[model samples]
Target: MPTRTASCTCGQLSIEVQGAPTGVGLCHCLACQQRTGSVFAALAGFAAPYQVTGSATEYVRTGDQGAKFIFRFCPVCGTNLFHTEDGITGRVSVAVGAFADPGFPAPQVSVYDCRRHPWVQLPPGAVAFKKDPP
Candidate 1:
């Protein structure tokens, strides 16, 4: 199993993840775009047993579907690091860009494709969904 370290912009907060990710995907939902200040957000999912170091600030918000999500970020740089949903347990969604690794694997799935910018092109063979997967 491979271990990867992801850090905040100012390096104030870091998380170490081991083994393969449960999933890798891109989100083009409006909330994601606003959160990342980008057209989309790339995320990697990991199960429990990951190690997190440094203090972080958390913001909780209710999604359109009424589910709540807790977003964790570095207090210094305000860089979004990871997020977890209220009902979901034992999984964390880390910002893929936080890893700052060029060799990271491409996203295997894309959600909220309806909101994806027309100019954005996903990798070949990537599965796309207009909304959350059923």
Candidate 2:
């Protein structure tokens, strides 16, 4: 299994994941935009056994559907490093940008297409959803 490590801007927090991501996606929801401070947010989800190092601060946000997601950030840099759903287990979603690799695999899924900026283009062949996929 290949391993990859992602760190915050200040290098205060990092996560090491073994193997390829189970899911790579882009989110254009309002909440995601706000959380990422960008037009969209890209995330890669990995299964359990991943390792997290250093301390972090957490912010919990409730989704539109009432599900809760816990977002963890670097305490020193305030960079949003990863997030986990309230009830979902065995997976963590890390900010793809944190990897700082331009060649990282493109997103396979795009959610909240309805909220995507008009000029922002989606990667070719990416599955898009007006909202969260069922």
Candidate 3:
């Protein structure tokens, strides 16, 4: 098993996860854009047994479905590092940029395409959804 580390810009907060991500995806929802300060958010989900170090500040937001998303970011640098959702246990979704790896896998899926910018392009062969998939 290969272990990968994702860290904050200030190097104060980080997570070490073993093996590949269970899922990787992109989100173009307004909230995601606001959270990332970008056109979209690229995320990778990993199962437990991962390790996190340093302090984090959490922000909780309610999704369109009413589920609460608890985002944990580095307090020192204000980087949104990882997050967990209500009812989604035993896994953490990390920001792909936090890994700082150009070779990180491309998103396998894209959600909220209806809100996606016309200039934004999805990776080739990536599945896209007009909205959240049921």
| lDDT by residue (tens digit), candidate 1, 26-110 | 9999999999999999999999878889999999989777889999999999999998988888888899999999988899999
Candidate 3: the clashing residue pairs are: none
Query: Cα lDDT for residue 54, model 3?
Result: 96
For lDDT, candidate 2 versus 3, the one ahead is 2
lDDT of each: 0.93, 0.95, 0.94
How close is every model to the real structure, measured as TM-score?
Answer: 0.95, 0.98, 0.97
Q: What digit string (tens of lDDT, one per residue) describes model 2 on residues 1-134?
A: 89999999999899999889999999999999998999999999999889999999999999888889999999899999999999999999999999999999999999999999999999999999999999
Local accuracy of candidate 3 as per-residue lDDT tens digits, 1-89: 99999999999999998889998999999999999999999999999888999989999999887889999998988999999997888
Q: After superposition, how far is residue 44 of candidate 1 from its true place, in Å?
A: 0.4
Looking at candidate 3, what is the lDDT of residue 67? Answer: 87
lDDT of 3 at 15: 94
TM-score order of candidates, best first? 2, 3, 1
- Highest lDDT: which candidate? 2
